[model samples]
Target: MQNNITIRGAREHNLKNISLDLPRNKLIVFTGLSGSGKSSLAFDTIFAEGQRRYVESLSAYARQFLGQMDKPDVDEIEGLSPAISIDQKAHSHNPRSTVATITEIYDYLRVLYARIGEPFSPISGKPVRKMTVDQIVDAVLKRTIELHSDPKEIKKRKGANHNEIFVMAPAIVGRKGEYHQLLQDFYHDGFLEARVDGKIVSLRDRIPLKRYQQHTIELLVDRVPLGWPIEQNKGLQQRLTEAVELALERGNDVVRVILDDGSEMLMSTRFTCPEDGFTFPEIEPRLFSFNSPYGACPECNGLGTVDLFSDDPCEACKGARLRTEALHVFINNRNIVDVTAMNIQTSLDFLSDLTLKASDAKIAEPILREILSRLTFLVDVGLHYLTLDRKAGSMSGGEAQRIRLASQIGSRLVGALYVLDEPTIGLHQRDNARLVETLESLRDLGNTIIVVEHDEDTIAAADYLVDIGPGAGKHGGEVIATGPMPKVLENKESSTCAHIRGDKQIPYPKKRREESKTFLE
Candidate 1:
């Protein structure tokens, strides 16, 4: 197998008959002054040829949509791989596009929450759990057994052999506005009595519930004694089952069982709250995606923010970009909005701390792994401060480029040619080391990375260096020096070598200018 990408007689742009052999699967830097044809050689010539070849290998129908690339003016080239370019261009300008959306982290978050998220009432702050008819029956029986086993309660009861239990369906609870139609429906259903706001009211009486105030109403199903003798009675079990079914039907799949001790239990046939009437829809990955209408805030259309004149928080969703119900769903006491709002580092901590029961671990393991891997890649590229909801358009050129780099690292593709243009464009000296380490990590993954860079640290750290200038523009485009770092620096004819060897230097200011208190004219 060929171990190098040999480029011969390449004349793309200002490059003058360039020919070189860049070692494959290595961190190779093309260094020189600006406009010295480093990008020309790395991107325009080599990357273009590699991409064009791969695209041409596809079906003609696919080629039309992809658009054909014109062949570069090169005599011959060998050892090319499928090419991927990571430049300084932002991935998108759509207001709905965010860091999480771009990296697909938000999609996984939705699935995780939907599958395992606990739903609670926004108004009452009570958890809602769905249960089957059998579950409700079992719960009532379990409570009865507990009461019978209590020594103090048994002593209080004395010779009493039974406990009376009230089976009721919550028709309404803590909701504002008049429900006159609902009252009529309950009356028509042959429910002779109801407990409205803790008052037992006859259905015949015209009880005017305040139209604007919140209220609770329960329809009386049956009152029966729960004892071993009562359990043996076939009619009692039948009545209990009928009461549970009636409650579920009348109370929107939820039922409340009240014991003689005044204790209450609520259960549902769906993920719903009988007390608060909160319902959770089925969870899927798309439900968390702002790009999809199912999970997107209807007010902002999943953009999170809105544009009245300029970008501002969305009035409908208050900038969450998800429906209120989605926001109400929680895992570990944090909602979807709260999780996406965290910085990468904080999110990593949260995810690392996340624990799943053994039962749920099998389902959650792969999903959590994928999400954490992408987040780790983002952190490795020094984007720990970026929140998941940060808009892509708000990123700097270098930041955007690094995001693409992070995404590529997460992809884990091997034996590919990656051409990056000025990846350190806006990075501070403090951040350059991490950037260099990131690039080297990619190279170590069996990828050939060709970086067009002017950063001294990057050039120094390169496994192989090609300095393509004695000067810029018309005076440049020749390979002034090519080899390992030491060889490149030792070449007298290379201007970059002269600087690296300390034979030449960019002069610094003799004295720093003093700051003026007032604006200069």
Candidate 2:
């Protein structure tokens, strides 16, 4: 049991020198005939007091961060929870908040999609080939070494300088498990075009040699080197890492060295190739690396989403912030909001203001007039959409409220305490139940809700009822009836209680379809 809350000399709104002690942790509903001080008790009395004390308890730095709330005009309130108040009040401006983004679910889904989704080439639209980073590194190294070595270096040491030897490399490794056929395909297509001994020959032009007749020739790797990548315009983070790795791979050695610059030096060793044992096959370098920036889709910046210029402004504003030729006029830069806010009403109005007449007035006149003329039509056409440069935090109340709901909805935080006032104030009746259902979901999250509502549908469904009025104004405030629906009706008092009770036993409050009559009784 909580320490009982005893209200002495209660004088908020309609409460006439009243006092009461209520139980804690109970789903105590405080219902009332409209305008009868239920709101004063729940919001102004309890929630407001709690909010004020919380603000005062914070440190100066924290207080700076927290928004202030005016204290309720009650004498005292105590034993409040570490409370959270959710109301129909909308959120402040924040443009980037969207349903998917506000809820963290979008981030989880993005990772899942990136990992398992099928990928296609951005340029050719072909299925992307998958390879481990190490495998790719190996292939690049092989191609790099082959290209770097000069056949002249081998000849120069072997003293077999009859003619030049052309070292060659292919653009693609033969598709795995298809090497022999790949050679055959290359020969058929005449892809091997370069020469050794000044005679152009296709490497795929195969001539088989019998192993028994073959003289031995050993081709050993004199040196193994890492693959060096060439890139430009990369961000500083990646560039710095790339530079460190590149430094690690630099130096001259006694064995054959293949520089990424495509030069090769053979050390002091020679291999005698029997004129018939080995075949020289030619292949060009394949540049099919996915991680390369050149392979990314240029438009999306690798994010896979494209942007197009929007024809209309955002939905927040219809457009007009002002009339024509206003003080905020800049024919080139001026928008109607600037015109309206800048105190520029008309070009004539701008000219008439003698205060503005003294400085740069002549220069300011034509610029103002031209803008005013365009804005006149824009305003008529309902083009008062937000300007290109509105702050995300300073939007109107309605826009902010919707954005707050959007944020909470996005958070995916289930089971919240949601309190709403007249959420439908600016909305048509068609919009009410939707708001009610939204409130219901928040309550369903195991929250204790206390709505101060006039909407009959919502009020009718309360689990408990406490109607707090005989009437509005100074005449109201006492808890006229406090019980389940059946008990409230037996009493002669509550106007709301009387309506729901259907007392032909008693008269009802004015309904919209009824004949107008003097005296509510």
Candidate 3:
């Protein structure tokens, strides 16, 4: 492969017929007066050709959607690669677009939560789980075996006359109602017996109850012998399956087993609290997405505000932008909202100190790695003060460009051409070196970086310098000097070289204006 990009007879815009050779995998800077054909050479001719070539390589169907790029007026060029341009343009104006979405950190977070997040019941304050029919059957069979083999259980049950366990559904819990109609409905549904307020009673009998008193009702589904090997008996297995299904349906996904010794065990076929019977939907990646209808808060519509122009938080989701269920599903005692609410530095600290269960860690390893890498890159680009949930439209042009730059670095792509325009425009002097260092790191990863900048720190950090201009616009289409900074500095004809050598300086004005007392705040 060629180690340089060779251009011949490139004429676009104000650029005169020019030819140049630019080094590959090196940090290159184009410096000149405003409108001096620097952008014409770096963007119009070079980057344009790269984009055109890439679009051309795609299928015809793909080309139509992307539109077409007009080829640059270059005689010939060689050794071009895929090009990515980062300029000082607002990244997005949509209120829905956020920093986390642009960097794809939130996508990984959704997957992480879906895979390992545990749902805790809002009503009972206990962990919930969903089990398959086969899982419930097998668990019950295993539990029976464990009990039969235990000497303590055997001794405790020696005096018990009954060897049968009851599978019951908690139909009603602590509700104030006479339930006369409810009992009639249950009788019509073929239920024979129910334990009312801890006392077993026949549903067929007219049992009167006080209307104002709180009552608990348990509907009996089926009974299994304690010593029966249900795992080996097909009839017993089928009966148990039907019983569990009936109990789950009657109890809103919950079932209870009363052992012969009077011990009770609770199980659920869905993510529901056994005590309160509050159920949650299946866990999926979409469930954590605030942009999707399935996961977004119903009242706020995932906007976090009822009014578009308002700063007040939504009354329902309370600014979380996710449904109640999504907020309740947590990992390491924090939900997705909690993590995204933190600034980059705080997020880094939180994730660094996070501890996960062994099983959860195994599933979350890759996702955590990606999220941490992107967050670290954002911090590296001097965005440690920004929150992941901050609206992208609210950021300054320089901040948006740096964010895109950080996302590009996090991508870790190699063998590409990156064109950046004035990346250090609005950055503080203290952060300039870190930006330069980030660009250098990108170059070290085998990418070619071409930056059109006038920042002294950026220019001093360049590996190759191209100065295009005798002047701006019409007078400046030609490359005045192209080489290492030291060699380019030797060229006295170049204005940038003259300035760099201290031959030209912007002197302070000889006259000063008086301060005015009147001012607009």
| Candidate 1 residue lDDT tens string, 394-472 | 8988888887787788778899999998888777687788889888888898999999987889989999999998778
- Better by lDDT, candidate 3 or 2: 3
User: Which candidate has the highest TM-score of all?
Assistant: 3
Highest lDDT scorer: 3
lDDT of 2 at 488: 59
Task: Tell me the spans in candidate 1 whose CA falls farther than 4 Å from its real position.
Answer: 133-270, 307-309, 514-521
lDDT-better candidate, 1 vs 2: 1
| lDDT of model 3, residue 168 | 87
Q: Write the per-residue lDDT of candidate 2 for residues 239-333, one digit (tens) a residue.
A: 33332233222211112223344343322111111221111111011111111222223333222223323234333223221111111123223
Model 2: worst 10 consecutive residues (lDDT sum): 280-289
TM per candidate: 0.72, 0.43, 0.74
Q: Candidate 3 overall Cα lDDT vs. reference? A: 0.86
Q: Assess each prediction's global lDDT (C-alpha) against the native.
A: 0.80, 0.41, 0.86
RMSD of 1: 12.6
Clashes of 3: 0
